[model samples]
Target: MSPLGRPVSLGGGVANRGQVFRLGAAVRRPVTPHSPATHALLRHLSRAGFDGAPRLLSADDRMEMLSWIPGVAARNPLPGWSLSDASLVSVAVLVRRFHDAVRGFDGGPHHWPRPVPPAYSDGLVGHNDLHPGNIVFDGERAVGLIDFDLAGPSGVVWDLATVARCWCPLVADADLPDGFVQGPERRYDRLVMLLDAYGLNRAGRVAVAESLVDNHDWTYRIVTDAASAGHPGFREYWAGVAARTSRARQWAVDHQAELIKAVRR
Candidate 1:
């Protein structure tokens, strides 16, 4: 089918939905500054039997097409399905399987949306954007990850940190939106649960705890860069998101010791 085919607008994604159009059972979006490496990454996922991500169909100068995954994409503050322990464990299992599968794929040198730190990237790619919105859940279980634009070379800890910060969320209450609700032990419980499911050791726990702090800043820096470059979406997201990230960074730093202690369990 042609790229200009009559298409339906895809919902759920907030930031990078520019020129996204879905046709029949496939979805397509402009490649733009995002590298062709994204196609390679998705192809790798397919070959590795990693079914946690969308299957890449094709890519050209105009757009990339992927097998449209059918499921509900979650939003922040989370929903009933995303909040359950069973769903949490299922998501963790998905991430672990992804890491195991990707370790066997060779990414070579390619342009990624974000760079992975040495401490976080050990020659393997991990989905760095495993947040509520990017995950597709069928009922109460995560079926697959939707956004691969930010997936690149990274270690398991980086992936685990992304999962924890979003699912568990270590940010301050002041940063949360009004009417948001979660249990008190949810943070520690979910984070430790993720750690346990990932089979992390003591050193790995320390590294992951530290990454919770770095990830806070790392996530915001990308936005700041986008805003500076005059990205409309980034500018709007920054107006409120920047402050939350700053506070979240501080929160992560303050709770690092506590997280380490808890993650070690």
Candidate 2:
């Protein structure tokens, strides 16, 4: 058996989460401004019976420890399996369950990170960043979510919008990985599949579509700001993706109607 407490570095992104290390049955990572709030949220999630999120173990000023969820998190140059329709639907289902599980959570006490606009703050503390890297999968099932750095109170539609943006993808053709290439129709169908799997109503579908542009803008600002502040990972990642992201923002604007129609259908 592997030695207990031996540091096994995990890879998911170019940021801090990428720098996380597994020590036996626990994960240790640098503390952020949002760490305390996230710990509180994790505690609440545990009490609320959500097993998909990590349990808060312990913390100090520099780092916090969490139960190491057992599953593979697909990293960059995402695997073909991670982009399959089955994986897409599974993650949608997981997000829905997470939303329902946080129904009675009180987020007022902790200052959560990444506040959405007041319009989309529907009192639900959601995992705003549901990209494949943050999701843990066992077979085709999305068994757990790992990152809480961007978790905060937001409308379920906004959260789902972020999902659709990343998964349906709402990106320029040039930005898609080999496994993600699809015609516009296929992309629209995937968006519909995702929303349908999540059990969104017509109103929710429309709201999610409308939120996509804002979501793109919001996400771009956050990354650019972090890069501006010289966050090493963000700086490096952003350097390579800045042009691609600009195209994605434009893509969201151009395809808003099609996305709305697809989800509504």
Candidate 3:
């Protein structure tokens, strides 16, 4: 059934666990318990007039369909516009709007693929895997967030921290991939810009600074666990990721004071 449709290989991604394909007007992915919740989220976004997310269309036992959002996903040969400060702010705005959209929606009876961390699960759901790969961009602007597979009960700080790590791209210089242009200079300034763009207050900033370190380790664990479980994508990604993960963790720790200062002002 999948082969019959056009394979919409829009570059590559780490969370591409599902064999996604594009049909006439929709994209398809494997069905999961989170499918219903994601579909519900789409409906809410539509009603709220949020155009930054795909709309859920239909589903079956094998695959679920979503409105095919036509845009560029942040990929390896990263688009020049995507790395701009304006693009970063647009993503932050989109994320903030997304959180606002889902703040009051109910997500009961849904078993997320994994358990959300206890500290981050108390109020409001988050797109736990918010990052460039998961986002769709129109030129320099973020248009939508796709892949709600990991969306579940989580707080704004936790989710935003993931965005910071990926968008501000809080990685050590040595860990950055070749051809990738993002660097470590003025990261504190970038962090402040991101937090401000997201409208996070002082307390929220404090929380995000702490979550930045925790989230990095949490993400590496998830990757290793996924790799050990035989997920090909993650396995390939994990081969030489440990050292980078350690370095990212240390970078966060090494700059905690600077991060806090950025948040303060």
Candidate 4:
């Protein structure tokens, strides 16, 4: 059991929801920018009328209290619930809302715990990792986003690419699960729809698509490096299916032009 009221499970730092635990009335970890940023981000979301994140309670000795989001996280390849139109739309809308909410807050001058590779020049900060597991779903709809560990000042386009990479998933058709492979064009179409829903301009779309190509290798390297430095969560993740996707990154590079055209169209 964690300082929170329930047993703690490791979150993917992006899409997978944090393990469920009961709320504890104490702060379990030392207060730092990392923890406070979660609080600030959550407060911003709440103030902006988005209710899909954990509610930050005052610090406790054992843990920071946050409201548990009850739903399944849409992990990689996206289980059935997240493949639908409704879930994609909801994800786009919610992330847009979250970005809007955080637009005004200062990230303060604190040093971030992790390396946040710069992408493009959009004013909004990037959530960085928008993998399927970070998104919580109720049936066929996205209800919340979790694990703000990588949130930082970044280009909005970068954030979009991260989301698209996981959701629209620019991998080779063969790399996709059976359900997604059957409707390749539909997936592309959904990418377009999600972009439109986020209210991105043509320039933003182009930047995001390009970034997806340019950043794939760098991002993978960073994840691998982090894992080697004794970050247990990342080490475990990299040791899993992600390590096997070396070819996938090469594929992205090989087909950059085609992917850009698909997303742009």
Task: Tell me the alpha-carbon RMSD of every candidate.
Answer: 2.4, 1.9, 2.6, 3.6
lDDT score at residue 254, model 3, on the 0-100 scale? 92
Q: List residue ranges in candidate 3 displaced over 4 A.
A: 1-7, 15-18, 76-79, 176-183
lDDT for 23 (candidate 3)? 75
List clashing residue pairs in candidate 3.
none
In lDDT terms, how accurate is model 1? 0.77
Q: Estimate, for each residue in 34-126, the C-alpha lDDT of model 4 and write its tens digit.
A: 766667766877787778776676665445556667788888756665777777888899888778777876665534455445446445555
lDDT of 1 by residue, 1-265 (tens): 5554668887655466556777877888777566577778788888888888888788788778888888888777566557777788888887888888787777667777768776678888778888888888898788888788887788788888888888776777675534335655467877888778777788887788878877767777778888889988878878867677777788888878888888777
lDDT by residue (55-156, candidate 3, tens digit) is 888788888878877787886434566768888899899999998888777776566656566876757777888867889888888888888887777889
What's each prediction's TM-score? 0.91, 0.94, 0.89, 0.82
Which predicted model would earn the best TM-score? 2
Candidate numbers sorted by TM-score from highest down = 2, 1, 3, 4
Clash count for candidate 1 is 0
lDDT-based ranking, best first? 2, 3, 1, 4
- Write model 2 residue lDDT over 119-146, tens digit each, in one string: 8888888888877788899987899998
- Report lDDT (Cα) of residue 253, candidate 1: 82
> Worst lDDT window (10 residues) for model 4?
21-30
Best by lDDT: 2
Q: What is the lDDT of residue 65 in candidate 4?
A: 52
Number of clashing pairs per prediction, in order = 0, 0, 0, 23
Model 3 reaches what TM-score against the true structure? 0.89
